[model samples]
Target: MPPPNERDPLLEISGLRTHFSTREGTVKAVDGASLTVPRATTVCVVGESGCGKSVTARSVLGLIDHPGKIVAGEIRWHRTDREPLDLAALSPTGPELRSIRGREIAMVFQEPMASLSPMYTVGDQLMEAIRLHKEVTKDEARSMALDLLRRVGIPRPEQRFGAYSFQLSGGMCQRIMIAIALACDPALLIADEPTTALDVTTQARIIDLLRDIQAETGMSMLFITHDLGVVAEIADEVVVMYLGTVVERGGVDEIFHDAKHPYTKALLGSIPRMGAGTRQRLTTIRGNVPHPSDRPSGCPFHPRCGDAVPGLCDVEEPPEVVFGPARSARCVLHAMERSVR
Candidate 1:
């Protein structure tokens, strides 16, 4: 038998450009985004909404809807059970992609209510995912679904099996979504803010659940969120995105303690300190993430960056500076260092 893929990167996204065509023009949702999700590890993609983290995940699974499409770049999946595949090239609705979607790569969507259907019982929904990938009898699927519900902390699995999504609380529904994703025991899991809608306690539980499952199953995870606290808790590596591009990425400790990019520093500064006064205001970035159509020239973040040089930062985009194999930042601040070298 082949060795486990734990030593290899489970997913490699390179220079990915996912775009949506509007009447006005093409909106680049994920422009030149690159990151790696190592097998048996968690890579958290952290950024404010509209930074294109979600689109990058969606592009990985070929799940982008009409008008939205992966226009360029490669999403290479180094599968545990099969040869490597470039997922970006696969047809979105084709059997090849569909076969891999849930079986090899599962996703826990951002919104449980929006992802679940009121027309079907939650059990059936979970069972359908299981049955689709595995050739199991109805009874077997049901038993597995119940076990999954229990594993995800749903109470009285049998009782909740027949209940519609509408009947469950937000947290319960989120758990159901997780159960469905875990049904196939995917090699990689993309969780897009799975705890955003839950209360603080529930959110902590969900994070713990994902961590436990990953430890048990040895599955890689791509967790997306804007909450730096959650990122610090769950991430092995961190990718900081701004506008539609990845501005910085490194190990979690490096990101929090030695952030290189201006945007990353600003984000870190915004996190509330433990001993700070409750009335003290947190640091905030100067401006909102630019609308896709209004992307600024040179550095997309220059308009809001405090370190922006008068002509250099606003006139020419900075190249990505590699501090080490596991650390990089795309910011003009590194230009002088590179030149001095």
Candidate 2:
């Protein structure tokens, strides 16, 4: 076997299994999902709604609520100033992780209005988050808040600071969410489908802003989205998920051009190509994502995979086949290709 190459990793999730207990049965929201976010790189987690992209992001923050817990895996957080931490082993309710939540790792939720409070002024909310992780006074916090709002491309930062979230447009509110997440200058930012509700033009601007911020701050980001178009625009690395597992992962160029797994190919094929005939229909994956409760026996995506070998793919799960240092896929097709060598 080849020796593993060195990694410039910030957050590394390995064999993560997050399960939710219900009256009916346990749902494995994230199972054996592994990916690495290197320093100053944007790793986009692309998959369908229930494919565990969001759940995996939540798991890193220790945000899985009661009845839902991380049963297994290691979330290794490598800090430059200190030794690496296995977050999965830490107590979710403990103060250590709480301190790390905003100070080092911050999250930008999907819905802006829902994430921000209606009662408090935008300034207060921003200042509160800043003060929580920082020792700055209220005035200092406000100054920082204004700077953040300005950095996020919000117009008239002074006026907008005192305004309520309800008063702002959807795009503006989303910008506020990004500012709040950036309050502490977190080393890692987890943006969970931040542009899902924005208009195309607004979405483009938000993406550009994020890209610029990353370049300036040198902070790594784990951006979750179902849109491959957004992925192409932002991702340095791409991790494709299916059901609850990472089906394929590699450089953005590798994933878009030289896809490995059939599921990844299906996903790439689904994108609307430009310059095609006006009536050209976009390709789509067949079959719906299987319910977590009635889990498939073998490969989670075998049912929908066009190239699945009936007897094998439907009977046994495939191991992740490594392609390069940081590229691989969990598909029998790759397994077959490797065995042929």
Candidate 3:
């Protein structure tokens, strides 16, 4: 957790809506989402697959291509010296946004193979990224590239720099991606399921590397993943999303120890814990998340939520219920409890 006296937020998102137009129908990938990333804080967004975690991050970076568009939103970015700028309004391919994309705010995607170019040498790519953002000579960029590789804990970075992406293992490729993303010293880093394809041991190493880098740089990060274990490992705050909406958000301890939303409770209950005695099967949340085009009428989660009250959860959307100084949830149970209190 960060200190209460933190002055300004690095990124502020409000009423964000991102929709994708398909032949079938428009998919509301991100609907009215909002959150804040305080400077030097890590906010982990956890949800099931297709819950809009990645879409929200892409929307912030203006990375949505052809079929997708930002219907409405305000993404305000506050740099160290300059005034805050609304990123949502900027042109997708404009020079200003491009300048900020990798330099001010960078993203490390889920699949390293997809992100890294197979044809380009790692050194060429990293050096090009450095030279693109900063007015550094080729020699200076090369030095910086090797330095970043080493900083990300890549063994024998100098030797690895000249290697192709395919030559490195999954873990090494991911570390290279992280190194490239951090090459410009970005103020905000968005990691979208960075360790999804790696083994358990490799995943732990990546998580540790991120924590170490965050501590060293004091940069804000938005870690997006579906894994609860990853959230528990790296998040200062947790945002639980369902069908493009944030059902609950709070400090890590608060969300884990005293989750208010029924969906959140179900999610926590689903995680397998050690020493719980052998059981025939692990607990599972019933029903799949509805498709974006076929979302339920009222609460998006009502169909799968076991504790959803009859009338309130099915007929009307619940208001955000503020529980403590830094915790809130969008759940009818929480709303009714607060009203009764």
Candidate 4:
């Protein structure tokens, strides 16, 4: 855990809300989420699909498209050399934010094919990203691009640079995505399910690559994934989400060893294990995650929580209960007990 005396935070998100409009109704994709990323620290946001993990990451980069907007809150970006900027208030089309999107804070999406243009060669895309953010000639950009590819562990990067997205495997494409994300030497990187589609071995390699790069570059990362195993592998801090709200958040040790939220415990229990005498059925939470328009009243997880108290959890939104200097949970079990004391 980082010391409390650390004065500078690379990224600070508070009460962030991203809402989307639809003919049926509005969807609160990200509802009042707050988090912080200390410089050079990795914080992982984990939740089931549709629980706003990706939306939160996208919102940080001000990448939400039409019909979706950051309705409230502040995203403070504190650069090493410049004054802090409020990202939430920045105009999407303005040059001020456009300058920071790739150069200061980069993002890697789930599907590289969707993010990478099929019409452009891999070298061209990487060179474009590098040249766009930095004052470099075409030849220098190409050389830097090749160096980034090699840094991401792509073999024979000079040869691979001429290849297209379709020519590379899923793992290779993800590496290329990482290379592009790192082209400008960003201070923070948002990786949204960066290894979801790859095979297990490839996923391991990607995770290792991220760790190595982070160590070498001193870059903070907000890694979004649903897999607890992945969180365990890469996270210094973990934020557990449910129905677009953060249920619990803490350091890796506090979360895995002393999980306070019932939802967190249930998620940990659901992980399949090896070497059990009998093949026990994996435990699962009873209900599906409610739709955005139909979220449960009070606590969003009340309907699915095995240990939910009848009146408290169902009637009132729980306050964040601080267990330690850096650990807290939003649950009635903690809130009510503290109130009664």
The superposed Cα distance between candidate 1 and the true structure at residue 286, in angstroms, equals: 1.1
The residue pairs in collision within model 3 are: none
Q: Residues 92-176, candidate 4, lDDT per residue (tens digit)?
A: 8889999998999999999988888999999999999998988999999988998899899999998999999999999999999
Worst 10 residues of 3 by lDDT: 1-10
Ranking 2 against 3 by lDDT, winner: 2
Against the reference, the lDDT scores of all candidates come to 0.91, 0.91, 0.90, 0.90
Model 4: residue 173 alpha-carbon error in angstroms? 0.7
* Clash counts for the predictions, in order: 0, 0, 0, 0
Candidate 2 Cα misplacement greater than 4 A, ranges:
1-7
Q: Encode model 1's per-residue lDDT on 1-341: one tens digit a residue.
A: 47765657889999999999999998989888999988899999999999999989889998898899888899999865678899999999899999998899999999999999999999999989999999999999999999999999999999999999999999999999999999999989999999888999999999999999998998889999999999999999999998789999999999999989989998888888888888878778997899987789999999998889989898898799999977999987797878887
Q: Mind sharing the TM-score for model 2?
A: 0.97
Using all chains and alpha carbons, the TM-scores for the candidates as numbered come to 0.97, 0.97, 0.96, 0.96
Worst ten in a row by lDDT for model 4: 1-10
- TM-score, cand. 1: 0.97
lDDT, model 4:
0.90
RMSD (CA, Å), each prediction: 1.3, 2.9, 2.3, 2.3
Over 34-144, each residue of candidate 2 has an lDDT whose tens digit, in order, gives: 999998889999988899999999999899988999999999998876788999998888999999998899999999999999999999999999999999998999999
Q: How far in Å is the alpha carbon of 187 misplaced in model 3? A: 0.7
